[model samples]
Target: MAKKKSPPETLLLLPKWPSSAPIVDTHTHLASTFEAYRTRYKDHATVFDMVRAFYHNTTVEALVDVWCEAPVRTVWREFADSALTPEDRTLKWGGIDYWFVMGVHPHEAQHYTDDIENDIIAAMSHPRCVGWGEMGLDYHYDNSPRDIQRSVFRRQLVHAVKLGKPLTIHTREADDDTELILKDLVPKDHKIHIHCFTDSPEFAQRLLDYFPNLYIGITGVITYATNTDTSTVIKNMIPSSLRILLETDAPFMVPANLYNSIPELKGKRLPISHSAMIPWTADFVAGLTEGKWDAERVMIEARENAKRVYGI
Candidate 1:
């Protein structure tokens, strides 16, 4: 028999959620399709095994087909009146209403600079491209060179400022460099967020202080003790109005810390790409707010902050 790591329930690390609140899963890797799977095509899926399983196969129409288009037009056209393309889905909810961040990640940066630069230019001209992404240093992996990562990230930030779009940053064990670069390079108008922040409270506070436009995206990591500590610290440190955002970052970071998190997900490939995860993300935050979930609060706060940063 195999030894099982205690179930999340036994771990008792349910993330915050709200019963009354709807949600907004703000920062995700979904738009970043190639970054997730450019190297490994072992399964013949376009992206890596984790991402393909997560986001590619949702049944829901309102929020289905985030990264990849569902083959059947029927599933998408029900809630949204559009064809089965990612561009169609973005326009379905409301014409050009849905938005996403795009860029070459640190790892892929080495190989795809020229192509990604073109993509960024095209995205800048796009009416709905709202942000520059999950593009920052990851010394944790050092998958790309330090200088190159800095160059691509800086270029993207410059573009974001030029476009007046917000920026979503991701860093791991590169906090010192992250802070140093942001301080020196971030433009006055660059709306910024350090998403999935798992760093110390002191760091969070300092960032909040330095960049008034800076936002912190808290995720399911808040539900677990370790993740909770980070969230608690940020909440305590940052002001209530500083554009705090929430995200699932799925079909990657599955906030599976809930007791009822995935009751029906059994034996399912999970599609790993559900936007439906937003409500769960909301409930997770609401749970932390008062041990009960309120979707409304999450939606309002998240949207208001998002609108402020995104100007949408």
Candidate 2:
């Protein structure tokens, strides 16, 4: 049996707001994750609309929302294509405005070949596609052959290098392969992020050494301490100059506190976590990184690192 649900309480917020802090979300499948959230929440018009409405009448700082998504599914493509309007393309960050890493996820790699890569190349020319990825390997599930994943990943790396854009990687269990292939394929000037990092700090150090430009994306894993308990190790071991960014990896990797009573949350448990839940994850990082800094500082610095990486 499940525990009874209670209304969420708004906790006291942090102080020491940084004026120039980017507050930029390094990675988020805003439309992909938010729309699913709105649909399931039944009352919310997707997480984006709810957030937009909430901030509508309020004066706020700049926010960079990424267009990450699993465009492989026909349903995903149709829904996202229809939801994005001319104005929805950029969420108005600074006077210029922008979006984050936009690309076909590795799970959808098999559906494309050179021709499809060409088509995606054309689409990637979209003004908002500043970062290329969510396109690394995943050994946990051999959903697509390793060969196909590498081919498409290499194609995008080439495209990103040509476009002078940054790269965002998504690696699962295939970390060594990811590092090797990227070292061989990725360009020297490109910015990169190994999103949802939870490996040992040694692995984190190795990643930095191999890909000096790569940023470690700290997700909600810091809150769920067991097998995913590598955040502290990463914090202690990795250098700050490498630049660490925070991401929700929402619609998955929901933080522990939100569902602690569920029991199963002691390990991996994904039902339908929302992209808007980034705050909970961000707060978790603050606590894990020795709690030396306030929440605002963490958000600000992480955002600044993302902006530097994405050129936002």
lDDT of 1 by residue, 2-36 (tens): 74332222122222333434345566544343343
For candidate 1, the 10 contiguous residues with the lowest summed lDDT are: 64-73
Q: In candidate 2, how many Å is residue 21 off?
A: 6.7
Q: Report the C-alpha lDDT of model 2 over 28-65, residue by residue, as the tens digit.
A: 55555555555434445554444454333222333334
The candidate 2 region of ten consecutive residues with least summed lDDT is 7-16
Top-scoring candidate (TM-score): 2
lDDT score at residue 125, model 1, on the 0-100 scale: 55
Error of 1 at 28 (Å): 2.8
Steric overlap count per candidate: 26, 2
